[model samples]
Target: MSTLLLSQDQVKELFTMKDIVEICEKTFQGFGEGTVINPTKVNLDLGETAAFPPYKGFMNAMPAYIGWTDIAGIKWAGGNLGERKRLGLPYVTSLIMLIDPKVGNFIAVMDGAFITNMRTGAQTAVALKYIFNNGSSEKKPIKLGLYGAGMQGHTQTLAISELFDIEEVRVYDVMKAAAEKYKKDMKDVVKGEIVVCDTPKEAAKGDAIVCVTQSKDKFLLDKWVKPGTVIFPMGSYQECDDAMLMNADKIIVDHIGQCLHRGALAELSEQGKITEDDIFGTIGELAAGKLSVGDYSDGKIVCIPIGTGAMDIAVASIAYKKAKEKGIGGTYSFV
Candidate 1:
């Protein structure tokens, strides 16, 4: 038995933003139509795991099976909150395994960190399609405000820029050097000017806001963002405040059960600040036009899509297919 092994760089080489976006769109439609079987993630407190000593982190297992695509997989990731700055390592690292359900064979082993970053960003773009430009109609050029200049931020920028026609990308990070580096690295490549912002609020001023921070506390003020701005609060809602979630004109979640368990709504659910009724609908519903949200071109909206397993599986399937065509990655006998 042979399983293809893909590194982070190989995954990056195999994945294109446009293709990833298409995969996400198709997978989301499948989700709405009940053609997929992706359930809520199972989170483990890594601190409680039997390590040499107590650790300070979390690990999660996300499993899914897309019957229509005949794809089954699980993605597992673990990381500490401040490990990146303190340990000089990635905050979150992950791996995924694809299986042929009929034979129960481990088909491939690939780095999930890159896939997670890209697919999460692609999911945000999918939500944006329905929120900002429903029916795929072109709207005015967008001015994008971005928070956090980490790897996830880079993926978010790359994914959104590839899919949307943005005029400017104003980025903010507590570390000035990081934001500067993001600008320096991305300015030449993207169509828009990459501007470094002095504050998170500065970065939050635009037609759309994307918060990619890994911070645990809420740093964003509700007043900072403009009315009718589409926001993607996707980093476990760590960067969001109560007002941002409470005041949004519309809210979409990737999955309601998943959200309630390990999503932006978890905290809100605890505080009695929100209920399922407050949610607009899942992104799947919006993508399938099952919801009756009209003229979303001018509304303050937010989507909280906790990264789902099926999204990763669908995208990895695409990448695997592409790699087969392009002869990418490495393979060796596992049996």
Candidate 2:
């Protein structure tokens, strides 16, 4: 059997945010319609203070075979925050393996980081497209407030900025240097001014707020948000406080069932701030036009996405196909 190997840079050039958005929208629709089979991701965690704790982390392998499409793959990723810092690199590293269902052979191996970021940003943008009224004059050029300046934050800003007619972007991070650097990096990519904010509160007052921090503790307050604003928290599991969830007029998640298990929703639900009935709907239902978000004038709306491996598999499948068509990746024979 011949296997294809793709580099990170090669995959990066082939898949754009727009492409990932389309894939995610379709995948989510399939998921909502009960057409997709995605099992719970398996997690194997290494203790906090292991000998090589920095290199020791959980490995999550998500396996799925889409019925609608002739694609099957698994996304394998591991997190090592301390090792990343020590090596001056990103915290999470991933790889995706695409397999041919008919032959049961390894088709390709590609970088999963790019897929992770793009799908995540695309999913968030899809949620916004469904939740917010695009035609309403009152909502044009949505004001965006952003926290955190890492990969997720940067790509999230890029994806949302392209989908919405954003008027301005207010950014904040604990590290002022990182925030400034992010602002500088996004200067040409964004049409609006990327102004650095002095505090998190300052960044949370716009029409839309996105928190992408890695903080384990809550950094945002519910009282700071105004009515008609939508908040997308993409940070750690417990990035937002209970007050934020309590004050929300509607709470939507990418996957309601999964969010209830591991994301911010789980944290809030555990605190008794919200219940199953409190969930308005999943982004997929809204994207498929099965549901509508009426007037959000009463309070804020929150959409939380816990990363999904299906997304990685989908994006990687696309990349793998393209690489083969263009004769990009080197081919090897495994006997």
Candidate 3:
């Protein structure tokens, strides 16, 4: 048998954010219906070192199977934030291995960074589609507030723009240059106006707020969040305070177990400030038609997406297929 090998550039050509969003919808639906098997990711901590200090490094092993698609895969992903500044390397690096579930043989291997960011952003888009009742047809333009102007930040705007008519995007970062760069880079990417804020609070007043920062500290105060606003905290660490979850009318997570392990609510769960009961349900339930947001026009919702292996496999499988059809990837015999 030959295994398909796809580089990052090849993977990017195989799919778009629109494609990812659609697949994510189906993937989450399958997850909710118990048609998908996504194990909780196992994390390996890499303690702080002088070489990778301040950021601390870690690796994650994420494995999943999509029964409907008949494919299985695992993602070996890791990141070192401090190394990015020191060594001019990417903060996150990942590779995905697609397997034929029947024979348990590797079918393809591909770069996962693009897939990671796109799917992570697409997850939020999927959540908003079901959680928020408002649509672009309402003629009420969306004002998006963002904390952390990085890769995920860019993709979040891209994904949300496909669902809402964004009139403005207010972004805040500790680095003024980064926020300014985001505004300039996203000017044409998003039809909305991009504003760089001096403070996190300035960016929190919006129709929807998203946090994709690397800050280990809590920056999003509950007081700054307005009513009827939906918050998406996509980072691994806690960005918003406990009240953000405590006072929220609805709290939907990508995976309940993963959320407790390392995402937005991890710290809260560890401290006994919040429990599984506090969570409304997984976004999968909403996607699968098992639950609905139901007239939440006046409610505050927090959707925490910690990233999922099922999504990675779903997207990777499509990319592999597309590459095969287009004759775009290298093949190596594994005899």
Candidate 1, poorest ten consecutive residues by summed lDDT: 46-55
For 1-335, candidate 1 gives per-residue lDDT tens digits of: 88888899999997678788888888888888888889888988765334634566788899999766787999998667544548788877899989888998888889998888788888887877777777474534677888888887787777776567778998999899999999888775457688898977778877778888766678878888777788877776447788888988888888888887555667888777888889889888878778745654545787787889999988887777788789998998878
Ranking by lDDT: 3, 1, 2
Q: Which candidate leads the pack in lDDT?
A: 3
lDDT of the structure predicted as candidate 3: 0.86
* lDDT of candidate model 2 versus the reference: 0.77
Those runs of model 3 whose alpha carbons end farther than 4 Å from true positions after fitting are 48-55, 134-140
For model 3, the run of ten residues with the poorest summed lDDT: 133-142
Per-residue lDDT for 262 in model 2?
A: 67
What is the C-alpha lDDT profile of model 3 across 197-272, one tens digit per residue? 9988899988789999888788899988878899988777888987888889988898888888787888789988
TM-score against truth, every candidate: 0.90, 0.91, 0.94
Give every collision pair in model 3. Answer: none
The local distance difference test score of each candidate is 0.80, 0.77, 0.86
Which pairs clash in model 1? none
Query: Using alpha carbons, what is the TM-score of model 2?
Result: 0.91
- List the candidates ranked by TM-score, beginning with the highest: 3, 2, 1
